[model samples]
Target: MRKFNVFIVLFTLFSLFISEKAKGFEQAGIYSAKIETNQQQQRIYGTVTDQNGETLPFVTVLVKGTNIGTTTDENGIYEINVPGNVTLIFSYMGFKDYEISTDGKTKLDVVLLESTVRLGEVVVTGYNTVERKHLASSIESVDMERVVSRPIIKLQEAFAGTVPGVTMLQGSTLPGDVPASISIRGISTLQNAEPLVIIDGMEQPLTDVDPNQVKSINILKDAAAASMYGSRGANGVIIIETHRGTTGQFKVNVNSWFALQNPLNLPKFVNSADFMRLRNEAYSIQGQPLLYTDADIQSAQEGKTPNTDWVKEIIERPATSYNTTASISGGGGVGTFNLMLGYIEENGLNKIEGSDKFSARFNTNINIADRFILLADFYAHRLKVDRLRRNNDGHGLYQIAWRMNPTQGIYYENTDIPNHYMLHNDMNPVAFINEGGTWNYMYDK
Candidate 1:
């Protein structure tokens, strides 16, 4: 029995030794054998630790010379059998690459630096690269990395508070008509001060271009900077560069976001009493009958009929807005082509009224004959505003509530109120509201 027990123990020890040897054999393959025979054998073992000293899993370990590679396990430990004189390469995206040599060491730890190309690198100017050394021209280049870092749906939203000297006023909330007024470097011309926008080498209206596809936006301010654009540059010039394809296999990218757009600011109007007083003054000065009796005037004074804040009443509502884009880009040594499709849906700030906007853009670019290149882009947009009314006309919401008679019933035949005559064709404020007219205004002719 003692001899049998001793034999069993020996067998168990032999099995374990064989198992370990098998494992070693599996790790050291044909490549390991070649290196061993050449007297250039190396057994490199290392642990990849992050900045927090925690083991990094699946870290790639490569020997620079012979294509011998291995990956670290969950415990952040890796082993590579290579020739002793070869260098090992370690790399991970967003981290600097590390290279080391094997002289006899068996353990190593590497920490990587975070890559920030935009912050430290030079920015592209016109044709050359310029270190932002203040060329002095009121030029404000919106930080693309900062703005793009946040998952923003619209490109215009990127201009929120970054563009110095530029003002963005929220207009309507309608998807396409999200009433926004973009004024660059202030209003220089009374006639039409809005700047001319050139997107991807194509001159187009700002409203026609959706912000979802913009990669970067650079604003050229100051007369000297904009002079190159001629008359259209009087207001200023905004250059929008869209995203393009990168070199590699074909790739697909989808960018989508859902957001709620509500009124950021609503102009305050006079209270019923204050509103009534202003109207009565205009009536008396115009030699018109007292439109409101004490009671009728009181109703308006106490927030009754004829005194309702129509602008607030009609325009205060929440709306859902969103943008989505799908893009594919990739190519070979010749060049690359990037394609993108995008869409947006939104409601206006007006509670019950709104607008719908649909837009499509296509950009195609290629190297014509090596040194010379050509790019073609087209943008088309359609807008439809429901509950369309002249809210900004002289006799529109404001003047009607401010200068019209307060006591007079909203509508009465043979009314005794005076109408605006300073402008010959100026219609009565009441008629302008209940009845509608049109003004001849066209620019694209």
Candidate 2:
């Protein structure tokens, strides 16, 4: 392999016609410069490399608008004589051409950027895999590295901008607002438009799986690809493969991240002063009794009196959340074993609304006999989520919070209940979250 590579490099360098032999001249900046050239011509030579500094053999170097050119050697070095100042053009297959002015100097190393088209690359498709040149179906691979680089709590959140044909709608920032649906081909039918998600050959909800455990994800979007799954593939198909044990020495991996959660856009509401003044003016115009007296209005406007903000009270801002996952994997001549443990704490927009999850997974492959291996895997997780209560009529806590009167206090000064202040209204958001009610959901799977 090394000899083959050396041969290719040498062939590429020799393919280009190098300049006159070096004689009694210093090197070009860093490389040996060819000298003893014509009085009217100058020596220009440099190495051509790719973005990563790998020497690119077979690169074409030419003086713009002329046939005078040379190909880069196996070492990517090209020595040429230029007649006065001119633009030097560097061209290579599979890379963008680079141009630079001689600018009256030597040592002009060039770097070329690789073209976006990646040919001959292998890709996974529906029920099969093929190279890019042979692939007839539309498939997208998710960048799991970029996805898990951050502290993402949900699977859909990691995929928002990672792949094409996936759409994420504006949903609540609350911890319980888990993604349940996705659209790839748009609304083609009236039934479930959610794409079919297959994890390790088992059909399941993508949102239920954790991003840390996922190894690779492939999406099948074209009609030809969807045909394999029948109607279920009409929406789309997502194939996921989880991380497994590796052979050789034992390895331990741990990942932990912290993130501050905040709403992208919070609703803007009128202040208590403006709200009170507007209400009083309306009452006066209707010939009804004024809600606030001159002194009361002055005090409220001057910020002397308390002006409650239900929205702020209902939603926690800049909530902090974190997650940690640890795994151990190894393999021997007889078997391989992998075990993982994870914990996550996710805070929601509303105080007292959050989620805690604990998960464990163990997988092993035992070679009971040659050519006959047994695979056993076990996974368990416990999840507990807390959120504000909702009524049968769908009047959720946030809706009630938005409609609360600005003047209505969260709680009365005195209350009949011992050691507890009574709420000014049955719909008080703070009271509901503090005492009225809340919903706690626990799941073990």
- In order, the Cα lDDT scores of the candidates are 0.58, 0.70
Best by lDDT: 2
**lDDT (Cα) of model 1:** 0.58
Q: What does the lDDT read for residue 178 in candidate 1?
A: 34
For residue 435, model 1's alpha carbon misses the true position, in angstroms, by 12
Clashes of each: 8, 5
- Badly placed stretches (over 4 Å) of model 2 are 1-120, 283-290, 302-305, 333-335, 349-351, 365-376, 390-395, 414-425
| Tens-place lDDT digits, model 1, residues 144-214 | 77775665544556677888888877553334433566788776764486777777766766656555567
Tell me the deviation in Å of residue 261 in model 1.
4.2
1-445: candidate 2 lDDT, tens digit per residue: 2433443354334323221111111124113212443346678988999888899887877665543566788999999887678788787768887889998788798989998766436566646667777777788888888888877887877767678777766454566456435677565573577788887666877655778988888888878555788887888888887777753335667677778866567678777778888888999999999887878778878877667788788765667777777676755435666777677777766567777877777788886643677878777888888866652122477787788777666655556755354455456667776675777888888
Backbone-clash count (model 1): 8
